[model samples]
Target: MYTKLKDELLVEAYEHAVRSQLDGEFLQILKEELDRRGIIFDEAKKVATADNNKS
Candidate 1:
């Protein structure tokens, strides 16, 4: 749940950042953070699937 919330916030922040025309460095940071969060979400899903299989 927290991850999902964070993802939503990141999306909003990204859009805002784009609209407001933030510096290149800040935009890159947000993009990298979003990408990292996506990897975390994918790993969580894989773990959940493996746990489900054990049951």
Candidate 2:
């Protein structure tokens, strides 16, 4: 059905976006920035969560 196909495409796009963020360069930048700021990944995630919550 059309609805099923749409759902499948949406899921594929979402997975692709997630995988794209897992690239080595991106991870290296994220780690370096977090280290420079003296914040762990979990703390950075919490800050992101807070920002999203405000929205």
Candidate 3:
């Protein structure tokens, strides 16, 4: 189902998923698809996570 989304949509969805803290198998599918498509999150979430953890 997720494989049909455009690159931009997929990236947005993945970012939202990460920000929303959505997990389980649903998020896994997004992660797998992103990797399969060679699409990365650009470390936006990575920086966020690091900042969040510093508190």
Best TM-score goes to which candidate? Answer: 3
lDDT of 2 by residue, 27-53 (tens): 665555444444322433333323344
List, residue by residue over 14-53, the lDDT tens digit for candidate 1: 7699999999899999889767655233433331223344
**Model 3, which residues run further than 4 Å from truth?**
1-3, 43-55
Give the C-alpha lDDT of model 1: 0.65
My TM-score estimates for the predictions, one after another, are 0.57, 0.35, 0.60
Q: Would you list the C-alpha lDDT of every candidate in the order shown?
A: 0.65, 0.45, 0.69
Stretches of candidate 1 exceeding 4 Å from the true structure: 1-5, 39-55
Each prediction's Cα RMSD?
7.9, 11.3, 9.9
Which has the greatest lDDT?
A: 3
For model 1 the local lDDT of residue 37 reads: 58
Comparing 1 and 3 by TM-score, which wins? 3
Tens-digit per-residue lDDT, 1-55, candidate 3: 4657776687778778988999767789988877777664444532222334469
Q: Supply the TM-score for candidate 3.
A: 0.60
- The order by descending TM-score is 3, 1, 2
